[model samples]
Target: MAHDPITAVVPAFNESETIASVVAYLIRAPEVNEVIVVDNNSVDNTASVASTAGARVVTETRQGMGHAFKAGVAAAQNDWVMKVDADLERFGPRLVSCLANARAPGIGLVKGAWQDPGDDMPMTRLLVQPAVAALCPALAELTAPNSGIYLMDRSRIAHTELRGNYAVDLDAMLRMAWAGHGVAEVDIGQIENDRRSPAHYSAMAHEIMGFFLDCARASSKASST
Candidate 1:
């Protein structure tokens, strides 16, 4: 895909402190035409803070990343969309180029791989990510399955069937592959993120495993038919 106006979608929950910085950096990027922050029913002043930062704010009452993302995508007015987390402070402008380079011909989805080898990734994530990579072909038909950052054409959104909660990213990728859309990953440099606590990590692992297993069974049934 050629360069065009990109709408950056940020799904935020109780992210009042960091949302402004994230939106500010995104708006400063020339390639990014707009920043849409979807507040996931946050009890804090996330919407107010995002509005002060000049981000177009949308409210999703349902408390899930996928629900926020779907609202943000639906609200975007640009041709291209990039979904990013609100807590990333040092996401460089080079991220735009990375996504652009990853856009293979006929590919609508491009994911960014975190490139810092020294960065601390959770132990559970490290173990689970490999399991995901091994199971994805039979489950989501995905490579780089855990990549959360994504750049995609807006037209593809209508064809996507995003499930609620944490399974959203995996579900969307699987549907995209099933629809024959191309997907690729680009190196987006190291991100300094607050690692999830052990309890949260364990919960995430369980959720991811359940989704993967469900996908695997569905894929198997489809193949058997």
Candidate 2:
């Protein structure tokens, strides 16, 4: 079956140093019909560089990845949308193919797993991932619940609720599973980017933990119904 046109939504903040290369790589994908860069109030020239590199730039006033994504998804013109990080220097061409393969009939969401590039995976993230897996069968239904790279059918967006912070990916996955939508993962090869410093990783872990806590409470309430 012929696939629908794809729109890649790249959410960036202070990514001036690498935004162009990321945009360039996505444009090379034959399946990508358009690229939209959503800048989340970056202090640098992320928007200017992205524009110069031939991407349509949209600015999101809210300062989180989820906010940037909401703006980008609202602006997307394609039937399908792929969320990609702006820091990647060389997103493999096959990455697009992997995502497409997961879109087989009945699949509503496809997530991409990262092959860590020699960076130590944070103990906190490692702890949270499996904990989420064990506690939330709705989200654990997916092979990789926290993957940032996701290809979603536009129609599914209406049913998925996105939290306003870092846990949006996990939140979306749980909702997709609860809706009885098919969710799967595609093994995208190694992302050769620098890892976040320990401090940044700590901050991410805190944010993820908060999100999961909220999810657990919400899920518990729903189960009582």
Highest-scoring model, TM-score: 2
Q: Pairing residues by index, what is the TM-score of model 1?
A: 0.87
Worst 10 residues of 2 by lDDT: 119-128
Q: What is the lDDT of residue 199 in candidate 1?
A: 90
Cα error of candidate 1 at position 206, Å? 1.9
Top-lDDT candidate index: 2
Separate clash counts for every candidate: 0, 0
Tell me how far candidate 2 lies from the true structure as C-alpha RMSD in angstroms: 2.1
TM-score per candidate, chains pooled? 0.87, 0.90
The lDDT of each candidate is 0.76, 0.79
The digit string of per-residue lDDT tens for model 2 on 21-138 reads 8898788888888999999999999999999998999999988888888788889998688889888875566887788667877778889976766754554257656867766555
Model 1: number of clashes? Answer: 0
Query: Which regions of candidate 1 deviate over 4 angstroms?
Result: 116-143, 157-160
Expressed as tens digits, the lDDT of each residue in 113-217 for candidate 1 is 775444545542564466555555543333356667888876865623576667777666666666777777777877777756679767766777787788778
